[model samples]
Target: MGEIIYLRDQHFAEFHDKCFLLLSASNHIELSRQLTKTLHHMLVTKNTPVALYHYLPTGQLRLIYYFSFGSNIEYEDEISSIRSFEALSHSQLTYYALNGEHETWGYVAHPPSSYIGSTHWISSLVDIAMHQLGLLSAKCIDRQQAKLKTSRRLLSKDIHLFTNIEEILDRHRQRWRDIFHACGICLASQGALHRFGHCPSDHQLLQQLSWLSNDAEQTDVIEFEGSHQGSLAVKLSLAGTHHGWLLLFRDQPFTNKHVDSAIHRALSCWLTYEARMARVLADDLALTIAALEISHTNRQFITTAQQLASLKPAIHSAPRAVTSAEQNNK
Candidate 1:
């Protein structure tokens, strides 16, 4: 709809040995699949090795497509190494957010000399694809935000009606697990904070929790490097209402900033549930005390009534002088 954006001529140097094209698209799975198909077709025609990398903003990077034209030993080794390690490290490809909304998809390839012209054509095609993908990304992000908003509202409503602290903690754990799964991360452990109950015995987690208790507002994410390869703790607090921490561990160290908004929403729900449970527990205790007091008061009243009835005859004579002489005197 607007001016078509293209990579500048000078930027071609970066694509000399290998080419990279970043598509600001959120439908990564479909787009990657389509690109793979197109590249496979190109491979069939040009007979070269091509690789497409699809990186989602949620920290998932996959080699969605790969094609090899011939059996060059060196090239095969390179492809094998890239497959094993590229996604694990940031050396081969660079990933950054696009306008803080879209993910950057990277493509790299080693084309044969015979396919130079075809490579140029593919680059031009990708330039046009990037623009279209950008538009699609914006729409996808909007839809995702709407869904997240709806989920938050429902969680908030449910949280306010919660009466058990355990339920709140369980929900918190499930939320962290879900978030980790969505981000393609493996979660080791997660739970609500407690002074002496059910908290992880790991020193790192305890230290993080101590720091969070000291100043919950200053920090949102804490990192731990210890027995666990990568441990992260997010501070969860609601002023005087509730205070807690969420711990997540993974095999590799990574930042949680990508899902910060989701974490905050989850923490809000947990805080609401915790506060409601505290009030419910307090109400239950008060009711129990009141019932005990009422029961004790009723027992005392019954005992006093019985004692008065026992002394009733001594306190008042009932028709004691009802003889004929007594009646004449009266």
Candidate 2:
């Protein structure tokens, strides 16, 4: 069993307790569905723009979800990669293949080495995940008559069946929350976070988060000061469309010790959840539209058939009337 670590961030600690309470009674997919619904409400209430990205085994990163308030950002570009889900990095090209640890949910890279969070915690998650995988793999091998290679291939092909979109979204959100808890301390001093544009150049920091971009990325930042008179500002760029950053500020000059780490943790989770929900909603919309078209077509066909059947008696009566008129003339 994995040991649960305490998050020292006050706000995050409260949120985590709430999350544990929410998750205790439910399974994984149910928890995620609830989380997405809750996150959507939060997005509307908070009026924040958030996006989620999932790392693919492929070198590219895909945008799984996003939620924006009054921001001008569009989710898709019907043509090319303009707004169409963009790929940020290749898996093999990165250090994840070498020193990085993999987990049932996903890989976690800690700071000093990586900025996401604790590498040890990430490694532990990976180990447990791998153990589960091993058990699953054994079951497959026992049930099948094929050799190990064939069994492996069969299991790989069916992995998606066992792990669907909802599970991925849930796990992704949770891992992101942990990362935020660990990394949130950095951005607590920042002010309200909002959507912004990104820089075109490849940034080293962005590269680690799999956000490296040649073209300018969208920027999201937290302005250090409120709508008051005068205040100094510091910016923290977050991972989002076109190099988005989060800005933090203070009314009076304050040190980093005053930062609220809990909010940062919450934001991380919110961003990931929002992104997943966005993609799922987009896909759902497409499916619903298609289903509606099919239903309309079927309805029209049924109406036409009914009308044709109703006209049959009238045609038969007309012929008989003509025959009777001919007999009378004779």
CA RMSD per model (angstroms): 15.2, 20.4
lDDT against true structure, model 1: 0.41
Q: Worst lDDT window (10 residues) for model 2?
A: 91-100
What are the lDDT scores of the predictions, listed in order? Answer: 0.41, 0.30
How does candidate 2 fare on TM-score?
0.23
Give TM-scores for every candidate, taking all chains together and pairing residue i with residue i: 0.39, 0.23
In model 1, residue pairs whose N, Cα or C atoms come closer than 3 Å (at least 3 residues apart or on different chains), thus clashing, are none
- Tens-place lDDT per residue, model 1, 5-84, is 34455434343222233353345444544444455454444445454544433343334344443444434434334422
- Model 2 deviation from the true structure expressed as Cα RMSD, one decimal place: 20.4
Kindly give the number of clashing pairs for every candidate: 0, 40
Candidate 1: Cα lDDT at 136: 62
Q: Can you tell me which runs of candidate 1 are displaced by over 4 Å? A: 1-26, 44-47, 54-105, 111-113, 164-330
Segments in model 2 whose C-alpha atoms lie over 4 Å from true places = 1-100, 103-285, 319-330
